[model samples]
Structures are given as structure tokens and as C-alpha cells.
Target: MTEIETIESFERHLRSGASLRGVVLQGLDLRGYTRELASVVLAGSVFLGCQLEQESVQAALAQGAMVFPPFLGLPYLPYRSGLYSTEELYAGFDPSRPESYADTLDARIYAHWSAQGRAHPVSIVEALAQRLHDHAITDAMEELLAGGGKHRKVVAIMGGHSMLRGQPDYRGVAVLARELTRHGFFMASGGGPGAMEATHVGAWFARRGEAELDAALAILARAPSYKDREWLSRAFEVRAAFPLSAEDRPACASLGIPTFHYGHEPPNAFATHVAKYFANSVREEGLITIAKAGIVYSPGSAGTIQEIFQDACQNHYNTVGVVSPMIFLGREFWTRTRPIYPLLEQLAQGQEYARFLRITDSLEEIVQALEEYDRFHTLSTIPR
Candidate 1:
């Protein structure tokens, strides 16, 4: 059941004289490996969306191997090996020319999605390809959360995508995320603008000083809203000004789970790993489900409220095995403006997760609550 996702891995396995039996070779170009294919025992092996020569395909089929041909005329790889990176998605982007975004891979795929009828594609082929791509993304995402050997202590920040960059709430969320990330927790967000962008921005500068973060925030504040023409350019400028060093990339790593369902809102550039999805529901559920350490609710709108209850449902039933803390970062926003915290408190009156609920205005309190939960959970899981 070994998976060979990269050409290098496939070559290394072949060189080691390992049998290809029951192996899964995904998204590879096996045209040059026709000789290897003929030499190896291909029984029970599966090749997914691989570019194979006619002879190689025939040989694989004859040897009882399954070969899924690559999906043609698509802007994306349905069997992508890993999660999307900022560089890969924004390859054609130019900070100076905002229109250049229309040419980027992310934009191109979004355009394709729109042309294919958004949520309802006319052709089954298109729908199937999109589903396959999302499945591959989920697979790659799980690998990322696994972090090679160690599991990430993931904490998601849910908020409104409309939260302006220069707002106090936005700044608060960013600072909270930076501190939490520095404390060994992996930060995750919806991966669009507003509070989501702030979450990643904080994590992006986790290895830097507060002054540098303040400087970046000042630059970003020039384009307060994502609708502004210079919003993306300002972000690029900030990235160019204070780039993460090679040593910092691993430490500053964070996850962004964005969706093409709301493709108008481009995924933020700060998240080291982008798990972009076509289905917003799948993406939404997955984002909440992965944040096992806890979730912080920043000031947000309807989408944020939806996520709050979705998370509540998970905790209410203990659906994901262990219930994690649900910390609300804005006391006034959650208790009065939106007034969700009080209702949630009432719903969890006698529940086990009730003790885990926290609504605080202080960032320090939020950090302490998450850290304490991590400590308690670790000790509780230890063998007696």
C-alpha cells in the first residue's frame, strides 16, 4: 500500500529493487519509465493521472495494473501530489500590475470553475475532475498536518472575510495568532482576507520582532479592504520587505483552507500551506475538524457565525473523539454585537465542553487557555 507521489520517490524505489506490487503511483509522467514498467511486476499497482506512453499503458494493463489517464484540457492536476504554495498559485502575478492576477494559476482555475457552472457543472466529467482534485488536496493536507513525523497542534481562527486590515479587531487577531504560533501551535484560517489574512500574517512573522510586524501592518493598512486595487500588491510588498528566512519557514508554517466557492476572495499569501478546495462545505468542515487544539473566534459576520455553530455541533456530540477549547477573542463582539457567546453558553449549560468555553478581550487569556488545554490534554492522554 505504498504511495509513490514524486518521480524521485519512484526512481529511488526502483533503484532499491522494490517490487511495484500494490503500489500507488500518482500524478507522475511515466513516459521515460516504459523500460522500468516492462521490467517490474506491475500486478495490483495503480497509476493515477500519469502520463504514460502507449506501450507502457498497454504493458500495465496486460500485467493487471490499473491506469487512470490524465484529465486533459484542465488548468489543474486532478491528482496533485501536495498542497498549493503561494509561489505556485501566484506564478504569473505582478505586484505593480494588479490585472496580472487574472493570469495566475489560482485565477485561471477559478475562471474555469465559473465557466463549468460553479457548484453545478453541466458535464459529469468536469464534476468528477473537481471532486478528484479536492480529494487529492485533502490527502496532501493530512500529510502536511502530520508534519513528517510530529503532529501539528492546530488551532483555527474563524472570522469575517470582510474584516478590514487596519481595524483593531484585525490587529488583535494577528497578534494573537503570532503569539500562539510562537508557543508551538500551528495557526489555521479560512485563508481569505480580513481576520483570516490577519491570522496567517501573524504566523508569517512569528520569527520576527513586534516592530517588524507593526511595519508590515502599516504597509497593509494602505489597502484596508481586499476590494481595494492595491490590496494584493501591498501584501506582496510586505512579503518582499520582510521575507521569512530558510530557517524560519518551518517554524512560521501555517495552514490556509480556502475555497473556490468564494473564489472572488483570493486566498491570502501568508499561509505556508494552502489547502484550497472547490466545495466550501467540505473546506469549512475540514478546517474546523483539523483544529484539534482549539478555535479562536475573532470579530466576523455571517460566515464566521456559521463556522461557530458548525464547530459547536462537533463539540456538542464529541463527534471528533476529543472536544477542544472554543475561545472567543472579542468579549463585546461575541457577547453583545453578535451575541453568539451567550447563546452558546446556554446550549452547553451541562455539557463537558462548557468548561472549555471562554470569552475574553485579553489576548493573553486566549493564549493561556489554549496552552492550558494542550497541557491538560497531553497529561490526560498519557499512560497511567
Candidate 2:
């Protein structure tokens, strides 16, 4: 396949004339732009999840272009090259009446996908298309982050999204995330609830004092879990009550890479931005890959365990140019119930990779580990 070019405007294509080939029209409105649109070359091109008039569709078909209608299970066009906004996902929702969520775009999208008999999709073709869209979104996300001079400084917090709102662990996650953000790290997470929400919450309140974080947590504590009746509403409530000013908030510092494959868990509202994807595997791998600074592992279940090994593999193989720190936040849980930490220690013994590993319950120790990594791998130029 030729390199694919995304075209969202008809006028842009018109400028290129008959040279249009290997183009992917992304939900662009081409109706009545020109009757001669059919005369242009379209071989090896695709009309990705676009809306078209009968004439345009027939013309594109005759000219050997592939037409794929908007994904029936998703509200927004799947081919668009951008991350989702809360406003876009909650389009029909009213802040004044936060209790009713059935009619919101986010809820509708979730419902549509859920009705398909899966939480995340498992089909081959669907997975391929979703992966393509995810790769584009990742590219766009990297460009946005790189533009802000925080390319490889991104850090991640790994934990189950099921952590309840008012719990001590959740508070610790939030505080740790806030401190990390204050230290100039671009905090990242799986983008779901629990510890992931806390990560974004910390980054969201990076410029504020501990008192403000306490206040926000107090408000969020009203609805402890995403399963609660007012979980989403309470988050909106806190956001509205303690709104971040434009001057104080650096918008793109934190990121959430959540997958719709786990659509049951909504993406946390606190993430400065989100790169939502349809493939969970891609989302999981990408989340680990971008956290060049290091990853902090909090208490979690199977998914978190999988991340531990995956991140270990990356460090063990010296992937991404250098090994990054891996800090375990819960000593008891990781050492006893899980016991994967000892195994990891055994594997790293007598190897240079051992320096990159740390297991501790102390948040301070976690911070020290990351700082040590930076000190040892000091860079002359800013990392990209």
C-alpha cells in the first residue's frame, strides 16, 4: 500500500487536481463541491467512514475507491485524526442536570458498543481498523506533547481503575500523581477510574496546593466509585467548583490512553487529554512505551500484573534506547498476595538492569528512584 494521506476538506483535494491517489477522506462533506469530482483519479484511495451523497458514492465506487460508512457502533466518525473532548463525548448532557446520563453522547457510544455483545471488540477486521485509528491518534498525541517540550519526560502510574474514590490508596495515588506533575513530569495512566483518575487529578491540580487537592478529593468522595449513581456527576461537580484557570493550567502536560474495548469503565475526566482507542492491547502497549521517565505500580489485579511483566520486558531488553525505572508502590500487596516482585528481583540479579528496579511502599522512595535514574542518565539536550 502507498503512504496514506488524510484529506478532510474537499477544497484541499481540489487543489491537488487529478493527482489524488492513496488519499483517505475522513468524514469530509464533498456534496455539491463540484459535479466533476467523479472525474478525478481515486484509485488506491479510501473514503474512510465518510458520509456521501448517492452520486458521490457511486462515482467513488466506479473510480475504484473503497467506501466504508461510519462505524455503526460508534457515535463519532472512527476515521477522524484527533482525541475526544469531554464536550464531544457528553454533547447532549446538561451540567445543570448531571443525574441523567442516558442521553449523553458518551453513554450512547458506550451503549452502542455494549449492545454488540462485547465490552471491547475481538473481531479481526474491526480490530485492524481500530488499530489504524489508534496509531493515528498516537501520532497526533505525540506531536502535541513534543510541541510542548515534554517528549520523553512523560511518566506513568499503573493500577486498577477499580480503586474507590474515598479510599486511602486512592488518596495516595492522587497525592503522588500531583507531586510528580509538580516535579515537571507529564503524568499518564490507563485513563480509567480509580488510580488512573487520581493520576489525572494530580496533574490537574499540579499548580495548586495540597489544600486544594484535599478539597477536590473531598468533593469526589461523595460518589466513591464509577458504579455509583452520581459518580460522573460528582466529578463534574468538583471540576466546576474548583475550576482551573487558563493561566495556571498547562493543558497538555498529562495524558490518558484509555481503550474503549473496556467501555464499561469510563475515562476519567481529570486527564488533561485522552488518546482513547478501540484496541486495548495497543492502548496498553502505547501507554507503557511513552512513559520514558518511569512507571509506578500501585495495587492492582490481573491487568496490572500484565503491565508489570510487559514493562519489565521493555526494560529487560533495553527497549526505547535506555531502561526506565519501575517502582512498586505497595510492598505488602506486591510482595505477599502477588509475589511477582521477588521473581523480578531474582531475574535482575547480577545484571545492570537491577539498577532500574525498585520495590517500595514509600512514595518518597519512588520519587528518589526516578531522580536517581535521571541523574545517572543525564542528557546534554532535551529528550524528544
Candidate 3:
């Protein structure tokens, strides 16, 4: 009754004349295996995306095997370990034609999913599939982080997706991300537009110098915002201009864990690796939790504020093991305009969270703060 965890194990059992009682066969192609199908016992087993003949399906059903069909035209899977590629999502799209976005794989998938609704309650099939897909993404993310191992520290930039591409703040964040990734820290963000795009774009250009980044930004400035007509097209233009040769790709990767909850804002291409998901709550909390080094908060709206307090709660309760730095990157915005920084500082006065919070206008200060944390503080060891 031992469970079969992989195709190799299933094949080995079949070859050895072993019983498949209580074995779970996930994602295995079971087509044209009449002999194996006839021999094996599939009681209490589950098969996902397994190809089988009609007789085999009936046999498996008779033996109590739960069979799930292969996903149709979905660009992602529940068991994949990496991010979606632009090529996969934009399959038939002509990069030269911005209007082709409407016909892309990503667009089609969004349309289908949106039609089903994204509220707390959804159809059992869609909800179950999405949950399973998200769980797989979490598993894949752990594998990714472990691939970096002890030498790599995860850090992230938090800010509004509304920040335009041509603005000073966007350029500044991009520069900061480029510098950080160059210095062995991995950069991550929400993976949408605005400041998030800037983070990935910076990491994309990490191997290059400031002038190249400026040049790239100038190219992006043509589009400015994601809502602009040429946003995706202009981004591809910059990507082409500063192409990353195979040898030039950074050893430290940048990630974008975007969610379909905000599918209207497309996930940027700059994030070399994207852990896109369906549940936004999981995406948000996990993004903050995984950045063991710390997070840099730029000026944002309600979403940013919510992240601040959510992060503060984690810091206050020491929720994730170590209390990494919480840096506010906009002095005037957070202090004079929002005043959230002062409030946070006031709240943290006698609390353990006080030591981790800092507000500054200088990007140099932000970089230095992270450097100090890496030098002195223990990295967060909390499990995902």
C-alpha cells in the first residue's frame, strides 16, 4: 500500500511486478500502458494530467483511482518550479504590435479566469486548481531560495505600482536595485508595473553601469506608465537595447511574485523569475517574509501603507524570527505628506520594532542600512 511518488517509481514497480496499491501517480502519462494498467492496483490513488485509454480510465476508476485531466491551454502548472517566460505568455504576439497583447496567451487566460470571478467564494473546480497551483508555486519558491543557499540573502523593494516609469523615484529605485543585486543581494517585488517594474529593470541591468541604466530608463520614459499605449512595447524596446548576453546574466536573480488578483496590471518582463499566483494575500505576506535581508519602502498609496503595518506587526511580534530593517525611502512623502513614518517611529519608541525602522530620502542611506543589517543582524530563518 505504499504510495508511488514519481513516474520513475511507478515504472519501476510495473517492471518489477509490484502491486500499486494505495500508490499516488501525479502528472504521469498513462496512455498505451495496457499491461501496466491491467497489472497495477490503483486503490486510493490520484492521477493528475495522466494520459490513459478509455479502458484504462475505466479500470482506474473501478480500482478507486481519482483521475484529473490535463490542464488545457493554461500557461502554468501546479508542479512547475520557476516563473513564466515572456515567450510562453506572449506566444503568438508580435512584439512590434502593441495591440497583439489582447490576443496573447496571458490575456486569454486572464479573460477566462476573470469571467469566473476572484472573490473569496468561487467554483470548487477553479478554486481547487488555483489553490493547488499556488501551493506548487510556494514549493517552487522554496526550491529557488534554497538554490541560492546561505550566501544569498533575499531583499525586496516595496512601493506603489502607480509610480510612472519616467519619474525620478522610478529611476532611483532601479539604480538601487541594480546596485543591490550587484552586491550579492537578490531583488524581488510585486512584479506589476511602476516601482515594481523599476526594481526588476534595475536587476536586469545590474551587470552594466549607471549610464546604461539611464539609457534604458530614457527608452522606457517614452511609455511612462503601464496604462500608456506603448508601455509593453517600449519596455521590450529597452530590453532589446540592453540585451543580456548569456554570459552577462547576473548570478544573483531578481524575482517578481505577482498575483492574478490584480491581473489588470500585467506582470513586467524585467523580472527574470516570476512566481505569479492566484491568491494575493499569500503573495503579499510571502513577499515580505522571504526578504530575509530587509525591505525598502518607497512612497505608495493604501496598499503600501497596509504593507507597512503588516510588516510592522511581523516586526513587533518578531513573527518571522529576526527583525530585518524596515526602511522608508521617501522622507517628505512619509514624513510630511503621509506622516506614517513618524507614527511608526512613535509606535516603535519603546518596542523592539524601533531598532529596525528608518526613514530617509537618500538611496545611499537605504543601501547602507541594508549593508549594516547584513553585517550585524542574523538573517531571518523562519520557514515559508
Q: Across residues 288-355, which tens digit of lDDT does each residue of candidate 3 receive?
A: 99987999999899998998888888888888987888999988999988889988898888887688
Q: What local distance difference test score does each model get?
A: 0.94, 0.77, 0.81
> 31-118 in candidate 2: lDDT tens per residue?
6644656667777677766667788788778888898776665564557656776656666765557656678766776675665544
Measured by TM-score, the strongest candidate is 1
Q: On TM-score, who's better, 1 or 2?
A: 1
For candidate 1, what is the TM-score? 0.99
Worst 10 residues of 3 by lDDT: 73-82
lDDT of 1 at 3: 91
Task: Name the lDDT value of residue 97 in candidate 2.
Answer: 75
Candidate 2 residue pairs in backbone clash: 120-261
Better of 2 and 3 by lDDT: 3
lDDT by residue (tens digit), candidate 1, 1-384: 899999999999999998899999999989998888889999899999999999989988999999988999999999999999999999989999999999999999999999999999999999999999999999999998897889999999999888998888889999999999999999999999999999999999998898999999999999999999989999999999999899999999999999999999999989989999998889999999999999999888889899999999999999999899999988888988999999999999999999999999999999999999999999999999
- Name the top lDDT candidate: 1
Sorting all predicted structures by TM-score, with the top scorer first, yields 1, 3, 2
Q: What's the distance in Å from true for residue 49, model 1?
A: 0.4
User: Which regions of candidate 3 fall more than 4 Å away from where they truly are?
Assistant: 1-47, 52-81, 120-122, 148-151, 250-252, 378-384
Q: Of models 1 and 3, which has the larger lDDT?
A: 1
